[model samples]
Target chain A: MSSEDLETPKEKGSTGEKQASEAPKPVLSSGSFLLVDYTIRIKETGELVDTTSEKEAREAGIYDASKLYKPRLAIIGKGMLLKAIEDELVTMSVGESKTFEISPEKAFGQRDPTKVKVYPIRKFKDVEAPLVVGARVNINGKEGIIRSIGSGRVQVDFNPYLAGKTLVCNVTIKKIITDDKEKVQQILHNRLPDVDIQKFTIELAPPEVVITLPEEAYLLPNLQIAKRLIAKEIQENIQGIERVKVIELYTKQT
Target chain B: MSSEDLETPKEKGSTGEKQASEAPKPVLSSGSFLLVDYTIRIKETGELVDTTSEKEAREAGIYDASKLYKPRLAIIGKGMLLKAIEDELVTMSVGESKTFEISPEKAFGQRDPTKVKVYPIRKFKDVEAPLVVGARVNINGKEGIIRSIGSGRVQVDFNPYLAGKTLVCNVTIKKIITDDKEKVQQILHNRLPDVDIQKFTIELAPPEVVITLPEEAYLLPNLQIAKRLIAKEIQENIQGIERVKVIELYTKQT
Candidate 1:
């Protein structure tokens, strides 16, 4: 697709069209952090599968609940995870926690049957197994781990998870790192490159931090928050800066 | 909880404990933006309800195919949306797209009678008349927008979806933004705090970016990849910097 075709309308303020006066961006100077804790459950069964409560996780582990192996964590705006999660994380302040249920429509998604394929047992030449029904096996040449074993069909579903399971994740915003804007941007980009730092800005306010992007970078979808997250990190690490403001200077289109 | 009680064995690198030297830590830095064009047909009747084609959506819109309003967008790591979508998003990369079909069990999930509640029409005093059977109506305070209006009793089910329905979503990876270290920590804390920027280190290797945290921050889950993302982002914006590193000189007990 041509670059022009990819450009969508910029996200306007919630009221639409009316530009909200830019408020004084709170600088998250050094020593600002967000602490968050959460639990994840199956939306259908309401069964707890994951949690940030290490103590509860340990307790569940004692009961042999392998679900407690890890708890979900993320830094707001860093793009280390999902935009929705980061959006929620950035909205929270210290010591504040909330639980929201995500639908299968919104959470993971409806399971796809095409993802479930029946492979022959010979595919597992190296894999040793009792190979009984309901047994889990590994696919030697596939992206997913085996979920179930069936009749001679050897149903080796490629999806990492059983289709149609709704997942609930409880997240706690533990701390927000506001310093090192440039570094935070590097983290989000996954590589250090030659770009103008002046092109970025971070504004920390309630609910989320706003990162303005240069016209050249605007085509990157969901990148607005990614920039804001980096700025938030710098504001958090630097002293006296309540928030990081990334101002993307207009650059000639490449 | 006592400080000692809070101290727990770090699960980092546990997945490959046997191959420690070559084993990359499970940084969990998976994130992707996907745009999928797909169609959903009932498993039993083969009736198409949802599709990526706008023409199809408009046609299906005429029916009670509430399933096709929004295209599925899954953000993996953060778990902000649905678990199934998140799982799929995590494993994908940018510029990649796929179409798949999900079973009812893996999509909306099996219908639960317990979730379906019957209420009285008096409860909906504000509702307009002509509440015929099969007509949708709102229920007491929940604002379901109505599923079906029944005799004497209103079968105002709370589920916003038609249970046991199969859905298809065509997903495209728009972009993948990895969380930076400082931001990841802030997300954990829920607020941004000013801190010594030198404390955290960022590494950009395969699987994800790694953030080496001080002992005080060691207990922070998913710290490694968060740092890597930050480092990668820094590398992108700064000149002559291939990678960003975080080093801690002192430690404090939280």
Candidate 2:
């Protein structure tokens, strides 16, 4: 093959997709940072499990002002989103919306018989909660529900609430991020929930990005760990990125 | 003053008790680090609120296997212990034990009438807990208790449980810490719960202490914050300490 053919392949697949027809479809990979909106439900009972849309949550009688209702940016294969959904997105292109059904095994795993155990009713003495069936109870920090109660015995199923249920999810990939700065910011936002990501200044130095934290962020607890996680996120997700230098400036109080 | 008198002043009450009779009584200072075991009781009801002794906790019917029953190491001015008790400790010596009663103002504060609010019974629709009087309920992350129930209205008191109650605390200073290594370790234990403090090794180099973390501790979440807090604790409590270097060595798995 001529040099033109080799050059064409690089140019066509490269980030600057000048030739739209020749460019490959933007397929999601393991560490792809994606902005997505999704709604998850129990396939059998049509019960809503979770949703990113505020309108859907209000209609389903599960709206909470504390919860953020917006398109979530998540790294595909890091268990930020469900593994089954992540697997399905690997073959899909950007802006693709699909309704898919996930089996119990693929979703939360099948219910195990060993997880259901009967214990003396006195075990829940500290738990002032009612022992009614289907009511969730926290036993030794592990949350479960009282499945049955009789003869001073309470049957508690430690299995996850959705363990045996099939999940039906309607997921839309709003955008597949290619910009390194946005990816870093997304990762920073995910790690440091309280700090405003937009306030921090990021400067590109080719293989490294210097993140200068704002004055307000200097006194934040666990800031060093946040910086470390940000560095790790940049190293793993962004291509050709090697180093992340975080500068925290502390101005003396007057 | 002569050089001998100036030298004598430093040795008078600074870590040594040689001139105990000549000098003033050795009183606890604000920054003093002490190993203490304390028992707190409600003065009005004579009900035990807390204790460091396992026997005391068991007798009070409030013992938990999860709680660490030991003399806690605390800095006097930091409010690690009760502020009222801390004030009493300022007058105490190294090995002194004192039983004192603290007023409601000095203890958990007086009960405010404004904190008692009447809400509609429908406000408890989300709460699965029993609507009985004195039932603790968490509303918007602040824990409160139901006080009364009338026609369509339920009264909830958001005041702290100990509010309006005077506290009688029996406090004993077991030992005053002088060694910087033990001081650092004690601070580490206080900061990082569950992790074995013995695993961390501290090497003192005047104005700096290097803390070597074990292999298992390298992966512990938010270790940077723990290290930062350790440094701050050492600097504030221990004399001549400035810097704390935390080294995490990762060994190659063969």
DockQ of each: 0.01, 0.04
How high a TM-score does candidate 1 get? 0.29
State the lDDT at A248 in candidate 1. 31
lDDT of 1 by residue, B44-161 (tens): 6666655546676667563434333333333344454546655655555444566666766777787776767777767767786456654555554554434566565776565646
State every prediction's TM-score relative to the real structure.
0.29, 0.49
* Candidate 2 lDDT tens digits, A1-254: 23232211122254554545574653567787887789999998999999999999999999998677767887887888888888877666666789999999998999998999898988988887887998899988888888999999999999999999999999977766777788888777777766776887887775777776665765576766666667777777787677676654322222
iRMS values in order, in angstroms?
14.7, 7.0
TM (B chain), model 1: 0.41
Q: Taking chain A by itself, what TM-score does each prediction score? A: 0.48, 0.82
Model 1, C-alpha of B244: deviation from truth (Å): 22
Off by over 4 Å in 1: A1-33, A46-49, A62-73, A129-136, A143-151, A176-254, B1-254
Report how far residue B86 has shifted in candidate 1, in Å.
66
Q: What range of 10 consecutive residues in model 1 chain A has the weakest lDDT sum?
A: A245-254
Among these predicted structures, which one has the highest DockQ?
A: 2
Question: TM-score of the A chain in candidate 1?
Answer: 0.48
